[model samples]
Target: MSTAVRRRRALTGRGAGALLAGLLLVIAANLLAAPILLYVALLLFLLVLFAVLVVHIPRRSGPVTRRISTDLLTVGEESQVAVRFDLRALRIPHGIWHDQLPPAVSGDATGEFPTDNGTSIRYAITGVRRGVWAVGPLTLHTIDPFGFAQRQQEFGETRTVTVVPEVVPLAPLSSNIGAAGGTAHTSSTRLGQGSDNLSPRFYVSGDSMRRIHWRATAHRGDLMVRQEEEESSPDALVVLDRTARRWERQGPTADVAFETAVSACASVALHLVQEGYGVDVLDSAGTVLGRLRGHEDDRDGLLVALAMVRPQGEARDIVSLFDGTPPGPLVLITGHLDEEDAALLRHGGASAPILLMTDPLPGAAEAAARLGWSSAPLRDDIGAAWEDALPARMATGGGHVQR
Candidate 1:
């Protein structure tokens, strides 16, 4: 049979008073007449003490296991964690179970359960922040059948849960410019392009008939197919502005500009990938999130990276980062743009598309005209601007206009 051991505080009130009276009576009998009365009183006191000890020892219950609804959840979503207690070893008259959750989860309260073979308790909480949260080490407390003593047991095993930011489908920004206009320079050395044949040269020993440019060969004396120039694919680099000066002026609540920028970048990247283009991301701190590789489903990785991003002290010059490469389209996403940055972008060797995201700058229109790029204010009505800025072909998939 199962056994329980308990340590309780000394008795008080009626019990203490009765014990004192019995002791006094015993002492009085010993001092006066009746030795028999003294022996009887001592026996009664010893029996009462043994009975109290027997009632104090509490019975032990079986172990418990806890399970949560999901190991990963999104912010603003509810988490339901259920704890199951096994009581086959000993019958529990009453018990209390408390599950400890991370501070990010709120609205949790202590729960009580009546004695039974099996007890399941549930806790409901809502995740308010984005990050990883751990839940476990449920504390179990039990009082003796007689309610004179209590015991506590802590289960150490724990589980980890990740809470990600809620993803809302933002209407594409009106001021989004296609990163496609720039000069394409050719190199002396020619490498094989991914495109199919344009024309064939003089039949080499191993040349195939399929590459023979028939139309050109008909006009020329020597056998020739359409000679195709090797085309270089445009590289899509997303530049995110993260300077402290840009975000520090916002109110106590987190600045929505950063969130808007991140969402815009993510949305654009997804669209570009679907259009068979290479995409890369560059932050103000010089950290690169993605490389100019073929598109894949990397939305989760990108969002998580954005979640931990914070404003930094150092500033990044857009021109320096784009120096020395062939002219290709560049996309800049920022809250504010200074004259130096604007001049560099406008005069930069490559044709650039600047997406200026600001909350109502004093001279936004003048700055945009001087830089020769489109500009749109950041606001709830931004959808119209995004629609206008997006290349008509991109919306219709006809073909992208060269900048």
Candidate 2:
């Protein structure tokens, strides 16, 4: 119990005992039969009456119950935190209630209800920021009928809620090949043919029958075959820097950068997924966040996983992570960048497009220029940068074709 509550209990006990003692004295004085005894009895009776009238009086009190619908939510979104107060056998004329909200939720209104009888009250809270929020030990205070004493009750369980960042869209930018006065030609090392299928096209004059599409010939009126073409559309691999040092602060400075990275990755992944391109996301610790396998239903799971992403103690070295032969088009998002990191990416064998996203570093533009990479500064408008870095025509009907 709190010190204040213990003190109040002690005061109430003493006052009750004193009132009882005065009543007993008055009863004994009535039996004395002498005038002085009678006068003394009347005086003691008056004193007891005064004590009861001025000090001891019924106070308001009852049990309070609260229930939170969810312990996790997203920023800038409203989650229903149901608060229920149960009052029983307590005649509370009027009382004000204040719910202790976490610092992240910056607002004055939580839930306040006045009651004269045993009843239940409910209210909702809307969280507006990210991080863990605590819903607290409710406090209730009331003044006694005589106004000489006050009673307070505290109840409800402490809860924690985690709020994640929000996701937005990105803008469009020109491709490096297009800017270099060379028509962009889509080429891939993967063995494949016409857009998707990997089977070879049928023989023309000396064409081999093995290359013919028997299924297509049966469906179509004429003979049809697959074409042997190198995989043109390269996969997009997104890498997010989630090292402990990256998200060192809990305030707007570091937190905003972390959120921006998450938002950018999510937006780009979703956009690419919708555009019929395979997408893979990797965190700083070399953990694959998501690898969509031509399945759109898995998008929700990806988002939920991202929502729970927290900085870990694992130290991530960007240079070593992508050291050897690289995969497809790589997009690296980080809060810090160095010369060695730039060199590692440039020599990382990422022949496909390489996009670097990081906080505004001292030599960001210069490093990007050296590596022949298009740089996007981390800002409130990072979503725009993400969109701009993507290929111009990345839709279902259109394919990255060679000129």
Candidate 3:
């Protein structure tokens, strides 16, 4: 919850009129030499001054508190805001309450201040964009009984509302892709399957004697044990290239292209998780942004992280990320991409990476195609791009799928 102190002081219509009349009467009295007019003017001046003092006096009130309807608010989502304040006594006869709202949120947060103690106001707010927005310091518009003077008082600390990036549902990976288990249940290779199919290898120091293969050990003149492979869920990487210079920004709101990329990253991560894949979100520079294992809480955490993610970093190579190991399935979402950048990504390992560019530079598409990468433009409808990448993914067998 947020509040503020006195913000401004000014004269009301009645106060301005009285002061002007008082001055006029004083001038008239001097011109006509009338003592009666002078006395009336003095009384009028006193009345105006008294009204100002009356409005400026302190009023008894308790601390203000605010509440938001939901813990999670996404961009373009609406939520209710309720503010409560204790007005023990009213020093001024009339006043209005206005809750201050930041530009990141939109709503009407104003009402008449109650004459009695304990007052509350409720209004609706729509998150205009993603970010942590300050809801307000409640402002009170106070006026004197005669409506001669007015003052505005702000109260309480501002409350923060976190608006996360919008997460859209994306299409599951095609079955032919043979990469993710989203479309089908993957089989586990744990020992219980069948001993006949299990292969034996030279026993290591850590091998248990109970698992030693006597038949293989006799033939090779060395101890051997059945190879043990545990069934594990598939995993994928969603990389967002947040190069600041690549995206164009509009005042207040984030860059449209960058926002689209963020949404795509979130959607892809969540979709892969739902499809039974352990997902890791990363930036183009190979920094891990978030990791999800198909948990309810983890999904929310990922969205929150992306909500505050900003475009950063200069040109950096991503080849180091997959230097010696293959990234099972990689999804790269970025703003602009040039031919050089596309060629640089080719050495990042053969996970049959999917490249989504908001603005693909000239010759970049040709370079991506030549490198056998599935490429598509990231747009408002993420499903379209997902669909476009499906054929390429299926043709290349997307990524290595553990059997």
Candidate 4:
């Protein structure tokens, strides 16, 4: 509860008119020497004063509570906000109320305060942008019974709602992806092994002597066991190049192109996870932003991470994100790809890799194609890039082979 009360009082239209009239009457009384006119002026002045005092009197208000319908909100989605406060602390007056909303939110925040039915009010708001938005400081506007004066009082603290990027649906990975040497349908061979299919792996603490592969151990000169890990899932990677030089910034968030890239990254990762692939979301500097391992995992966490991602870091070669290993279902979301950058990325082993660019400089697309990368210009229709790259991956040979 806040003991501090901030109040603003002002005269209504009628009160202003009355004060003007009282001034005129006082002038007339001085000119005409009529005591009757002076009496009328004094009454008018007192009435205006009384109205002001009625509205400005200090009054204590009870604590206010606010509640939101959902824990998180997605862009363009609506959420309900409910407010409750005590009405008995002061003599209620007929007035209107408004809830202050940030620019990122859209909705009607004003309504009649102290409804005849109850002491609570509810309003709906739609998230217009991605980020944390504060919606609060309910303000009550009261008018005197005679409508001569008005008062405004703000109550309660601010509450925040997180809005995440919209995740659009993406087409399934092309069937030819696996044939082109992508591990989209299977786990990375070097990372883990399947229980149903026996494979060699380093011995763990609980490994049984019966499951040891002595021949493999002797060949590798290290103890190996046939990993029976049932929890292992196929891995995929979504590399987001947010280097500041590559994107345009509008403010704290990147421009529309970067927003599209973020959404594309989210959609691609979600699609892969639904298709039974463990997805790792990485930035341009080889930093892992978020990871989704199982189909049943909570995806909101990943979306929240992407919601806060902005254009940062200096320009660097994206090849570092591969970490010298053959990546699976590789999707690189970048901006302003040039020939020199394309040439440097050719060394990685991502068979039929998908390159989604916001702005592809002249000759950049050609170089990417020459490196066996399926390239597409990113746009509002996210699936267009997916569809365009699918056919190219289907026709090309795997692993940096020229088309």
- Compute each candidate's TM-score over C-alphas: 0.54, 0.58, 0.80, 0.80
lDDT by residue for model 2 (254-337), tens:
476777777777776665555445666878787878875456555655666677676675545544555354544567776666
Better-scoring candidate (lDDT), 2 or 4:
4
lDDT of 4 by residue, 26-77 (tens): 9999999998999999999998988777777847365678898977788779
lDDT of each: 0.56, 0.56, 0.76, 0.75
Of the two candidates 2 and 4, the one with more favorable TM-score, higher being better, is 4
Best by TM-score: 4
Residue range with the least summed lDDT across 10 consecutive positions in model 2: 179-188
Judging by TM-score, tell me the better candidate of 2 and 3.
3
Clashes of each: 11, 8, 11, 0
Worst 10 residues of 4 by lDDT: 394-403
The alpha-carbon lDDT assigned to residue 5 of candidate 3 equals 46
Candidate 4 TM-score, C-alpha based: 0.80
The residue ranges of model 1 lying beyond 4 angstroms of the native Cα positions read 1-98, 103-127, 136-154, 170-234, 249-253, 292-297, 322-330, 336-360, 379-403
